[model samples]
Target: MLRLSKKTDYALMAMKHLALHGDRGASSAREIAEQYDIPAELMAKVLQRLVRRGLLLSHQGTRGGYQLARPATLMSVADVIQAVDGPLTVTACSTDDHACDQYTKCSVRDPLWRIKDRILTALAACTLAEIVDDTSVPTIPVTLSRRTPAPVTER
Candidate 1:
């Protein structure tokens, strides 16, 4: 499964929160954390990383926190993911030399490459504003769960 790291997830959540609130001023990490039920320390670290990445601007002292360094509409989901998780490639071979033994004869390699490109492109096209404003439609997947029945109890 393609999953985002907890750090990335929290970062997205924090950014979304800021985007939703708009440019009223900076938001403290503690405030954002408490509002979102995230750990203050972890969120603070994520926010700091975002600041260093130029995605957010941080203010210090009493009435200080963070604000978007750029407009939310200008920030892409891929940007956020990349800032935290490095690259979005699903396979190790996607970014570097073919480490897989089947690379020489893999029939699915080309198609997989195409899929990765399409996915990254799509993600790049989507912006934080689109995610937080609800102005755009999102494509979410619905999975059915199959639960096994429990064994009969002993007499």
Candidate 2:
């Protein structure tokens, strides 16, 4: 199953909190972590990673903390995730890297690559603003809907 690491999850939560309360000035990592019941040390590490990645700006002072380096609308979710977890990869051997032992006979490799690209595209298209905003963000076309289809009728 596809999943985001715990650190990545913390980074996203911190970002949303920062976006929501950014206007109030920089927020200390402890403050944000406490709001969500996360470990302060771990959240601080995540924020530091974001800071190093240029996704967040760190302020050094008595009242200083961390804040978004740019507008939330301009930063994609992919940026945040990548900063926290490096690159996103769903398969063992992506098209660019066929280092897997089964690369030669892997029939599903190419198709999985396409699916990986789609996932990356979707992540890159979604902005951090959408996470904290109540308004709708544009929806992506989905091949599968979780809901069951109604019975077919005779035309």
Candidate 3:
């Protein structure tokens, strides 16, 4: 199943937290971790990775903490995910590694690659600002309007 790693999830949470408090100055990793009930050590690692990726700025000292390197609107979900988990791949064949033994006869590889592209595009379209601003809504609307069939008459 396609799923985001836990580190990516934590990174998104931390980014959203910072975005929400962008005007409040930098926030310590501990603060963000405590706010979301995540492990402080893990959050620190995630935040450090973000910093290395240039997505976040880290400060040092008594009041040191972390903040977004750029506006949340300019940072896409894909950015955070990629920073912590690398590229998004729905199938083994979708990646350049291509270690699958069936590479020579993989019939679904092309379709899977297309699907992976679509997923990545969708993630890219979603910015951290949308999440932090509570504006993240599905592009496609879903309706549950199926009618219930009447009970069959007894014979």
Best by lDDT: 2
In angstroms, give how far residue 32 of model 3 lies from its true place. Answer: 0.6
| lDDT agreement of model 1 with the native | 0.86
Ordered from best to worst lDDT, the candidate numbers read 2, 3, 1
Off by over 4 Å in 1: 138-155
Residue by residue across 1-155, what tens digits does model 1's lDDT show? 67899999999999999887756888999999999899999999999889888999899999788989889889999999888888777665754677888888888777877888888898898899998976684775757669767889999
Q: What lDDT does candidate 1 reach at residue 52?
A: 83
Tell me which of candidates 1 and 2 scores higher on TM-score. Answer: 2
Per residue, candidate 2 scores C-alpha lDDT tens digits across 6-71 of 999999999999999999999999899899999999999999999999999999998999999999
Clashing pairs in 2: none
For model 2, the superposed segments whose C-alpha errors exceed 4 Å read 95-98, 144-155
Cα displacement (angstroms), candidate 3, residue 31, comes to 0.6
Clash number for every model? 0, 0, 0
* Candidate lDDT (C-alpha), each: 0.86, 0.91, 0.90
Structure candidate 3, residue pairs in collision: none
Write candidate 3's Cα lDDT for 23-135 as tens digits. 98999999999999999999999999999999999999987899999998899999999999997887766556668899888888889989889889988998998888775
